[model samples]
Target: MAYTISDACVSCGACLDSCPVDAIKEGNPYTIEDTCIDCGSCEDTCPAGAISAG
Candidate 1:
Protein backbone atom coordinates (compact mmCIF):
# COMPACT_ATOMS: atom_id res chain seq x y z
CA MET A 1 0.00 0.00 0.00
CA ALA A 2 1.01 3.60 -0.56
CA TYR A 3 1.59 6.10 2.18
CA THR A 4 -1.17 8.62 2.90
CA ILE A 5 -0.93 12.19 4.07
CA SER A 6 -3.37 13.34 6.71
CA ASP A 7 -4.95 16.72 7.35
CA ALA A 8 -2.22 17.37 9.87
CA CYS A 9 0.15 17.98 7.00
CA VAL A 10 1.76 21.41 7.23
CA SER A 11 2.55 21.69 3.49
CA CYS A 12 6.20 21.92 4.50
CA GLY A 13 7.33 20.04 1.38
CA ALA A 14 9.63 17.89 3.46
CA CYS A 15 8.13 14.69 2.14
CA LEU A 16 8.51 15.68 -1.49
CA ASP A 17 12.27 15.26 -1.54
CA SER A 18 12.02 11.93 0.22
CA CYS A 19 9.77 10.13 -2.29
CA PRO A 20 12.11 8.00 -4.38
CA VAL A 21 9.47 7.37 -7.06
CA ASP A 22 8.32 10.98 -7.23
CA ALA A 23 4.82 9.90 -6.32
CA ILE A 24 4.05 12.81 -4.06
CA LYS A 25 2.23 15.82 -5.45
CA GLU A 26 2.08 19.39 -4.18
CA GLY A 27 -1.19 20.46 -2.56
CA ASN A 28 -2.72 21.88 0.59
CA PRO A 29 -1.71 18.81 2.49
CA TYR A 30 0.17 17.14 -0.34
CA THR A 31 -1.01 13.93 -2.03
CA ILE A 32 0.44 10.53 -2.78
CA GLU A 33 0.05 9.60 -6.41
CA ASP A 34 -0.85 6.07 -7.60
CA THR A 35 2.74 5.50 -8.59
CA CYS A 36 3.76 5.43 -4.94
CA ILE A 37 5.97 2.44 -4.32
CA ASP A 38 4.82 1.99 -0.71
CA CYS A 39 8.21 3.08 0.54
CA GLY A 40 8.26 4.67 3.97
CA SER A 41 10.56 7.49 2.87
CA CYS A 42 7.81 10.10 2.86
CA GLU A 43 6.54 8.93 6.19
CA ASP A 44 9.99 9.18 7.67
CA THR A 45 10.54 12.62 6.21
CA CYS A 46 7.18 14.15 7.17
CA PRO A 47 7.82 16.72 9.84
CA ALA A 48 4.18 16.99 10.85
CA GLY A 49 3.87 13.25 11.23
CA ALA A 50 0.99 13.27 8.74
CA ILE A 51 2.06 10.46 6.44
CA SER A 52 0.92 6.96 7.23
CA ALA A 53 0.67 3.56 5.60
CA GLY A 54 -2.54 3.05 3.68
Candidate 2:
Protein backbone atom coordinates (compact mmCIF):
# COMPACT_ATOMS: atom_id res chain seq x y z
CA MET A 1 0.00 0.00 0.00
CA ALA A 2 0.96 3.61 -0.47
CA TYR A 3 1.74 5.95 2.38
CA THR A 4 -0.75 8.68 3.29
CA ILE A 5 -0.49 11.93 5.18
CA SER A 6 -2.90 12.35 8.07
CA ASP A 7 -4.62 15.38 9.57
CA ALA A 8 -1.75 15.71 11.99
CA CYS A 9 0.39 17.10 9.19
CA VAL A 10 1.62 20.61 9.93
CA SER A 11 2.40 21.49 6.30
CA CYS A 12 6.02 21.79 7.22
CA GLY A 13 7.11 20.61 3.77
CA ALA A 14 9.46 18.05 5.25
CA CYS A 15 8.11 15.22 3.15
CA LEU A 16 8.21 17.16 -0.10
CA ASP A 17 11.85 16.59 -1.02
CA SER A 18 11.91 13.17 0.60
CA CYS A 19 9.67 11.44 -1.93
CA PRO A 20 11.94 9.63 -4.38
CA VAL A 21 9.04 8.89 -6.70
CA ASP A 22 7.82 12.47 -6.44
CA ALA A 23 4.32 11.28 -5.68
CA ILE A 24 3.57 13.68 -2.86
CA LYS A 25 1.50 16.77 -3.62
CA GLU A 26 1.42 20.12 -1.83
CA GLY A 27 -1.41 20.78 0.63
CA ASN A 28 -2.26 21.03 4.30
CA PRO A 29 -1.76 17.37 5.05
CA TYR A 30 -0.24 16.79 1.63
CA THR A 31 -1.41 14.10 -0.79
CA ILE A 32 0.35 10.87 -1.73
CA GLU A 33 -0.46 9.72 -5.20
CA ASP A 34 -0.83 6.18 -6.58
CA THR A 35 2.64 6.49 -8.05
CA CYS A 36 4.04 6.18 -4.55
CA ILE A 37 6.41 3.24 -4.26
CA ASP A 38 5.99 2.86 -0.47
CA CYS A 39 9.66 3.64 0.11
CA GLY A 40 8.91 5.03 3.58
CA SER A 41 11.11 8.06 2.88
CA CYS A 42 8.32 10.57 3.47
CA GLU A 43 7.23 8.78 6.63
CA ASP A 44 10.68 9.24 8.08
CA THR A 45 10.94 12.86 6.99
CA CYS A 46 7.54 13.91 8.33
CA PRO A 47 8.12 15.76 11.56
CA ALA A 48 4.48 15.70 12.60
CA GLY A 49 4.20 11.90 12.35
CA ALA A 50 1.43 12.35 9.81
CA ILE A 51 2.58 9.78 7.30
CA SER A 52 1.61 6.10 7.35
CA ALA A 53 0.96 3.09 5.18
CA GLY A 54 -2.46 3.20 3.60
Candidate 3:
Protein backbone atom coordinates (compact mmCIF):
# COMPACT_ATOMS: atom_id res chain seq x y z
CA MET A 1 0.00 0.00 0.00
CA ALA A 2 1.02 3.56 -0.50
CA TYR A 3 0.47 6.75 1.41
CA THR A 4 -2.45 9.05 0.55
CA ILE A 5 -2.70 12.74 1.20
CA SER A 6 -5.96 13.93 2.72
CA ASP A 7 -7.85 17.20 2.53
CA ALA A 8 -6.34 18.20 5.81
CA CYS A 9 -3.08 18.83 4.03
CA VAL A 10 -1.89 22.39 4.28
CA SER A 11 0.19 22.25 1.10
CA CYS A 12 3.17 23.30 3.20
CA GLY A 13 5.53 21.06 1.24
CA ALA A 14 6.81 19.43 4.39
CA CYS A 15 6.31 15.93 3.03
CA LEU A 16 7.95 16.71 -0.31
CA ASP A 17 11.61 16.09 0.47
CA SER A 18 10.75 13.41 3.01
CA CYS A 19 9.81 11.00 0.25
CA PRO A 20 12.83 8.84 -0.48
CA VAL A 21 11.40 7.72 -3.81
CA ASP A 22 10.19 11.20 -4.76
CA ALA A 23 6.64 9.90 -5.02
CA ILE A 24 5.10 12.89 -3.38
CA LYS A 25 4.10 15.70 -5.71
CA GLU A 26 3.29 19.31 -5.02
CA GLY A 27 -0.36 20.32 -5.36
CA ASN A 28 -3.27 21.82 -3.50
CA PRO A 29 -3.06 19.16 -0.82
CA TYR A 30 -0.07 17.34 -2.34
CA THR A 31 -0.23 13.91 -3.95
CA ILE A 32 1.45 10.50 -3.76
CA GLU A 33 2.36 8.97 -7.05
CA ASP A 34 2.34 5.24 -7.87
CA THR A 35 6.10 5.16 -7.35
CA CYS A 36 5.58 5.33 -3.61
CA ILE A 37 7.61 2.77 -1.69
CA ASP A 38 5.30 2.83 1.30
CA CYS A 39 8.18 3.81 3.56
CA GLY A 40 5.99 6.15 5.63
CA SER A 41 8.53 8.94 5.28
CA CYS A 42 5.98 11.44 3.97
CA GLU A 43 3.48 10.50 6.63
CA ASP A 44 6.01 10.99 9.38
CA THR A 45 7.07 14.36 8.06
CA CYS A 46 3.57 15.69 7.35
CA PRO A 47 2.91 18.58 9.67
CA ALA A 48 -0.84 18.54 9.07
CA GLY A 49 -1.08 14.78 9.58
CA ALA A 50 -2.55 14.53 6.09
CA ILE A 51 -0.67 11.50 4.86
CA SER A 52 -1.76 7.96 5.74
CA ALA A 53 -1.35 4.37 4.54
CA GLY A 54 -3.65 3.68 1.64
Candidate 4:
Protein backbone atom coordinates (compact mmCIF):
# COMPACT_ATOMS: atom_id res chain seq x y z
CA MET A 1 0.00 0.00 0.00
CA ALA A 2 0.93 3.62 -0.35
CA TYR A 3 1.94 5.91 2.46
CA THR A 4 -0.94 7.88 3.94
CA ILE A 5 -1.08 11.03 6.00
CA SER A 6 -3.48 10.90 8.91
CA ASP A 7 -5.51 13.36 10.96
CA ALA A 8 -2.52 14.16 13.12
CA CYS A 9 -1.15 16.23 10.25
CA VAL A 10 -0.30 19.78 11.20
CA SER A 11 -0.09 20.88 7.53
CA CYS A 12 3.46 21.91 8.20
CA GLY A 13 4.33 21.36 4.50
CA ALA A 14 7.36 19.27 5.41
CA CYS A 15 6.07 16.10 3.79
CA LEU A 16 5.03 18.02 0.67
CA ASP A 17 8.61 18.88 -0.13
CA SER A 18 10.03 15.49 0.85
CA CYS A 19 7.96 13.27 -1.39
CA PRO A 20 10.02 12.35 -4.44
CA VAL A 21 6.99 11.09 -6.29
CA ASP A 22 5.32 14.40 -5.72
CA ALA A 23 2.53 12.54 -4.01
CA ILE A 24 2.05 14.74 -0.98
CA LYS A 25 -0.23 17.51 -2.07
CA GLU A 26 -1.61 20.51 -0.17
CA GLY A 27 -5.07 19.64 1.05
CA ASN A 28 -7.10 19.14 4.21
CA PRO A 29 -4.74 16.42 5.42
CA TYR A 30 -2.56 15.90 2.32
CA THR A 31 -2.24 12.76 0.23
CA ILE A 32 0.42 10.19 -0.80
CA GLU A 33 1.56 8.42 -3.94
CA ASP A 34 0.33 4.98 -4.84
CA THR A 35 3.83 4.71 -6.25
CA CYS A 36 5.35 5.34 -2.84
CA ILE A 37 8.78 4.01 -2.02
CA ASP A 38 7.89 3.71 1.65
CA CYS A 39 11.16 5.48 2.39
CA GLY A 40 9.54 6.99 5.48
CA SER A 41 11.13 10.35 4.88
CA CYS A 42 7.76 12.03 5.17
CA GLU A 43 7.27 10.35 8.51
CA ASP A 44 10.75 11.40 9.51
CA THR A 45 10.13 15.02 8.61
CA CYS A 46 6.57 15.28 9.88
CA PRO A 47 6.23 17.18 13.15
CA ALA A 48 2.60 16.18 13.68
CA GLY A 49 2.95 12.38 13.58
CA ALA A 50 0.90 12.32 10.38
CA ILE A 51 2.58 10.20 7.71
CA SER A 52 2.54 6.40 7.83
CA ALA A 53 4.06 3.70 5.60
CA GLY A 54 1.43 1.35 4.33
How do all models score by TM-score?
Answer: 0.92, 0.90, 0.91, 0.80
lDDT of each: 0.90, 0.89, 0.86, 0.81
CA RMSD per model (angstroms):
0.8, 0.9, 0.8, 1.4
Which candidate leads in lDDT? 1
For residues 1-54, could you state the per-residue lDDT of candidate 2 as single tens digits?
A: 868789998998889899888999998768999899889999998889999987
Pitting candidate 1 against candidate 4, the one with the higher TM-score is 1
Q: Clashing pairs in model 1?
A: none
After superposing all C-alphas onto the true structure, candidate 4 shows an RMSD in angstroms of 1.4
How well does candidate 2 score on lDDT at residue 17?
Answer: 91
Q: What is the lDDT of candidate 2?
A: 0.89
Q: Is candidate 2 or candidate 4 better by TM-score?
A: 2
Compute the lDDT of residue 6 as modeled in candidate 1: 93
Candidate 3 clashes between residue pairs 3 or more apart in a chain or in different chains:
none
Give the alpha carbon lDDT tens digit for every residue of 1-54 in model 1: 757889999999889898888999999889999999887999998888999997
Error of 2 at 22 (Å): 0.9
Off by over 4 Å in 2: none
- Regions of model 4 farther than 4 Å from truth: none
Q: What is the lDDT of candidate 4?
A: 0.81
CA lDDT of 19 in candidate 2? 85
